[model samples]
Target: MAAWGSTLWLLLHWQVDLKSVLIYLAVLLMMHLYTGLFITAHDAMHGVVAPGNKKLNTFIGTVTAGLFAYNYYGRLYPKHHQHHRHVATDQDPDYHGGNFFLWFLSFARQYITVWQILLMAGTYHLLQHWFPLENIILFWMLPAVLATFQLFYFGTYLPHRGEHEPGNRHRSGTQRRNHVWAFLSCYFFGYHYEHHDKPYLPWWKLYQEKDRLLKENERV
Candidate 1:
């Protein structure tokens, strides 16, 4: 569904021009909205959003990620699960990846160097030249930038740091801030500690369980 939608939009966009900037902006917004839908598919694949529906969730995730040639379900699911089990602990794969600078730099390198930008650009050009349209570059460039931003910033990089429970550091205000950013940026993925403590809970419900556990611990 996502791939088809993107292809359809690209085809339509090939015919648009500078006179269609408003239309281009509208398409850009739609693409951004679809990026959120992609995230939901990702959550479903993790079984953190739709428990007991693994097959359905996996199918949706595959389709959504497939649009960008990303196979998160096939490649990253087990790895992500491992991260959850060892989260904030030294054993966590996500934590050892890097600090802030390495995180952002690595992300930029992967995102831009990956086939995302190239594939999108090629698709647009192919459609435009084969079909012959006006102001096609406008349609192509913005969507590419938007897709790049979505994948790099929102999808891969930010979500990783959402929950910071360093095994070395006991806990701090910085960790709390990290959680806030995680929730806001990655749709509550910032509750990494809670998710780690209770992996079976759905993503939406993880925070509730976290709070419950926190209260219970405090009373002790």
Candidate 2:
């Protein structure tokens, strides 16, 4: 969250040429920032953050989720819990055992509530006079949309689906075990097996746990 705010601060005060046609590069950075923020909210939903304090945890989750694109954490919590409890099954709203694009569209549609769109449209309407329309679309709106794809692909579809070795606890799969790439890709969520086995641990801790588990396996 701090990094996200810092990026916004830089964008606001850095005096970049927003009118330039090449401002789309900043869109990539914004996409990443949005993805990171959503990942934080995802962690909170898993009860891996502030486990003892329900109010504080939900507060943090709601703020991050809303900032990503006006998501209500309270609404998301029940749905997310259902996903965890019945992952890769018909009950999991995120899982679609059909075509990739079709499944993705369905998954995204489930989370993209009507109120979210109204909130964003209303926000953009109010900010139009103050912020450049192009900047708002490219930096704010486009990135939020792209970030959904990034989160869905890396954090959900890839880790939970695709070709993978059969993990013991859950049927989830881990990506290539490069710590940097794992963190960069999905905030260490590529270690999906570790995550399912230790749902109480935050994303950052998954890397260390992955290594320790591998060492134990080697010893065996």
Query: Which has the greatest lDDT?
Result: 2
Q: Among all windows of ten consecutive residues in candidate 2, which has the lowest summed lDDT? A: 7-16
Tell me the whole-model lDDT of each prediction, alpha carbons only: 0.54, 0.82
Candidate 1 residue lDDT tens string, 10-56 = 65545454575676665565455455555565576567554677777
Q: What is the TM-score of each candidate against the true structure?
A: 0.56, 0.90
Off by over 4 Å in 1: 1-35, 48-50, 68-72, 85-93, 96-99, 107-118, 127-184, 217-220
List, residue by residue over 76-113, the lDDT tens digit for candidate 2.
88988898888788898888887779889889788988
Cα RMSD of all models vs. native, in order, equals 5.8, 2.4
Total clashing pairs in model 2 = 0
Q: Which candidate is the best by TM-score?
A: 2
Q: List the residue pairs that clash in candidate 1.
A: 48-203
Candidate 1 lands at a TM-score of: 0.56
lDDT of 1: 0.54
**CA error at residue 12 for candidate 2, angstroms:** 4.6
